[model samples]
Target: MVFQFDDLKKKTILLFISAPLVGAGIGFSFMFFAIKNQPTLGETPWRTYLNIGASDESMLQKAIRTRVGIYALPKEEVIYFMASTDSDGELLTSDQRYEVSGIAPATKIWSITLYDKDFFLSDNALNRHHFNASSLNVEQGKPFSFVVSSTPEVGNWLPAPQKGNFALCYRFYLPPASAFPINESSLPKIKKL
Candidate 1:
């Protein structure tokens, strides 16, 4: 039998329609396996806690090797630095406490937030998940400290959970380049509490 143009057109149309479905199926299968087999943060050096022989100079290298993304700050940028469970070398308990601290440039608004290993803010009844420098308690010209404990403290207390380990993520937005450069050296050092 001779092949007809109509048959060819129909087959082409069918392939076009079916290709995406097959591709999607394969993509989802791959993603499922990837997620299932993902290595725990502890299994890799990059994922290991920070502050292990870490200083301001070497901190950026640690972040890069671990794929911890940091953006360059803007000129006249104000930086908020803090330490938390995400800071370094400390295993956090759901019931344990932690804190992040840093000096803000005498100019901009700055805040710190705590996130679980999943990178989402903890859901709590109080709705108090972040601490801003302006709103935090500062005793002297030094960096302000926020307390992390299972029990709430008087100032900037972030409640810890009772179930799993957690990582505290800090964000320094709107930083000026005058003091804190746009380079990696400008990123704040996060010390694990």
Candidate 2:
């Protein structure tokens, strides 16, 4: 049998159509896994703290941020710290009690917000979802500490959901110029109790 020009044209058309679909599928899979496995700045297997740059984010970083649905302010305007685990490297669960302690960096205002594993505000009974610097009970210019648990706690308590894993989002608004170049050392420490 002899090959015909019609067969060549049909194959070429099929290639043109199927190539993009295959490429798109592979590209999407790669992006999904890339974003899933990408490590944050101060990340261990259990804890992750995202460190976003001011104006120097890579394309992959920007895509990951977008995928996570984070509308981060310019680094000069705000800084963020995120954690989903405790110092002992355990996933933060509603049944476990945790404590976070640190001084608010020299910023105009700071807040700690709680979110469920899906990044929605945890449905807490106290109707409280966050604690800000203005709401904290500071002692003589000393560092602040707060407890996170399903139970009620006294003094700077952040309520965790009744069930499932949760995360914390710490934000500093209008931070001083000196607050730039943040690192894990400057953030609070979370420990399970």
Candidate 3:
């Protein structure tokens, strides 16, 4: 024998079956996109994922690598921080211009790379995505500065997409032990200008 429900009952059953699915979908999407977490090793807007490239990498870091496709080295060799906000804890949006200034970390090599909300190199007319110690203008005992904006700037312009959010990745290669405890002052300051 086959059992059939009335129109109202059918609709109610459909809602019951789909509601949790919809809720779970929303939760999963948020997890995939933002992957929110408290700062583990740095102040506002800067965070270091511990145990990266090791056998016991944290679950959060694993998910981040999967989402961003980041290829990280061992912790001793590479200490990297990814910042999605500014010094004032404001989300880094492309619509606004920003000044990124800081003293370079003493390491074998280092770079500050910018990625769009989707964790990919933002496509812009300038075709610039990252600035390394070698590429940036580094003078003896002087701080470096750059402008991050969609429009062209006078010097050291890192083109940002016109809309949506962005993130900055600061990676130091073969860094010294002192660099492990990254001084907040040493990290590049992201100030909306």
Candidate 4:
């Protein structure tokens, strides 16, 4: 086939514009899926722990972490356990009620905060957003338990958006040495009711 100079220029221009658009689409798709499906570093069946390493994170891992809002903090100083689903492996929605139960162990402090699917605090009638060890009224030698739901509940209620998926961030500040190498037993169980 014979090609004219004018035709070739038009094709080149089309290639230049479309190539970036295609590349960008693919890049965005990859990033979205990568972050969405990325496995947690130290994951149990109910909860997942993010291993914010001091160094040696790949570019894709870093991108995923950034997208998920994993911030800078020394592992020894604090540990984070996150859950977006119930023990039944169902995505957590405010339509159902959930219970999170576990002993705090001997940590300096611990807290559980509720966040919407977008990782922002949800707006609700109750201004309450989080509950910490200090704020909770725990009887000595008794395990701690809390309810997560859109409806009001007795005792340690963590509010959730009335009509969307939500997540829980369990933070242990200045955790003890035994808290390292977390396992299912060490983490709280989140069960849907």
The candidate scoring highest on lDDT is 3
Off by over 4 Å in 2: 2-18, 40-56, 139-141
Clashing pairs for predicted structure model 3, backbone only: none
Ranking by lDDT: 3, 4, 2, 1
Model 2: per-residue Cα lDDT over 1-193, one tens digit each: 8979999999999999999999989877877897556554464322232456536667766776766647766656666666777765578899999888887667647888889998899776789999877788553236988899899988778999989998888877877766656555667778888
Ten-residue region with minimum lDDT total, candidate 1: 43-52
Q: Pick the candidate with the highest TM-score.
A: 4
2 or 4, greater by lDDT: 4
TM-score of 4: 0.85
Ranking by TM-score: 4, 2, 3, 1
After best superposition, candidate 3 residue 148: deviation in angstroms?
0.3
TM agreement with the true structure for every prediction: 0.48, 0.78, 0.76, 0.85
Predicted candidate 4 versus true structure: per-residue lDDT over 33-91, tens digit per residue: 87666554344434443556747877776776677756746668777667787766688
TM-score of 2: 0.78
lDDT of 3 at 50: 53
What lDDT score belongs to each candidate, Candidate 1 first? 0.52, 0.74, 0.79, 0.76
Clashes of 1: 12
Clashing pairs in 4: none
Superposed Cα deviation of residue 16, candidate 4 (Å): 2.9
